[model samples]
Target: MESDDLSSLSEKKLKKLINETQDVLDQLKAELKQRKLDRQHHEIDHMEDYFEDAEHNLSNLRLFIQKVFSEIRKR
Candidate 1:
C-alpha cells in the first residue's frame, strides 16, 4: 500500500500486506472484546472503574482499516 501504484506490486507483496493488515485488524477486534468484558465486570462488581475509555477506540480502528483499504484500492 505504500507504493504509488498498487498494480505494479507483485502478488507476493500484495498478499503479505493483506495478511499483515488482517492480523492487525484481528488484534483490534480482540482488544475491543476484552475491553467490553472488563467494562461489564466492573459494572457488576460495583467498582466505578473499567478501562475508562469510550468505544471510540474500537470505532476508530474500523475506520482506520477502511481508510487503509480504500487507499490501497485507489492506488
Candidate 2:
C-alpha cells in the first residue's frame, strides 16, 4: 500500500497485517531451509555412489595384480 493508505490504518488493523506478514515470511524461510537440506542430501548420495564404485574398481585391480605376480613367479 502507498504511504497515504498505510497512514489511514488503525493500530489493530496494522498489527494484524504485521502478524500475517510475519507468518508468511516464516513459512518461506522454512521452505528455503528444507530445499537447501535436500540439495545437500542429494550431494551426499552422489558421493556415496562414487566411493562404492571406486572401492569395487580397486578390489578388481588388486586381484588382477595378484594373479599377474603369481604368473611371473611361476615363469
Candidate 3:
C-alpha cells in the first residue's frame, strides 16, 4: 500500500513539472518572435538611410559635372 501511494505522488509531481516547462517554452517562443520583428524593422530603416545618402551624393556629382562642362565651353 505504501508503495502505491508513493507511485501516485511521483506521478502528480511529474505532471506538474511538465505543465510548468510547457508554459515557459510558450513564453520564450513569443519573445523570440517579437525580437525577430524588431530586427526586421531596424534593417528596413537602415536600408532607407543608405539609399538617401546615395541619392544626395548623386545629386552633388551631377552639379559638379555641369559646372565642369560650362567651364570647358567658356575655354
In terms of TM-score, the best-performing candidate is: 2
Q: What is the full ranking by lDDT, best candidate first?
A: 2, 3, 1
Tens-digit lDDT track for model 1 on 8-71?
8889988998999999999999999999999988787864343445535888799899999999
**Candidate 3 segments exceeding 4 Å error:** 1-9, 50-75
Model 2 regions more than 4 Å off: 49-75
lDDT for residue 31 in candidate 3, whole number 0-100 = 97
lDDT accuracy of residue 22 in candidate 2:
100
Model 1: residue 34 alpha-carbon error in angstroms: 0.5
Find the 10 residues in a row with the least total lDDT in model 1: 47-56
Cα lDDT tens digits, model 2, 18-41, are: 999999999999999999999999
| TM of each candidate vs. truth | 0.55, 0.62, 0.49
- Shift of residue 18 alpha carbon in model 3, Å: 0.5
| Full-model lDDT for every candidate | 0.85, 0.94, 0.87
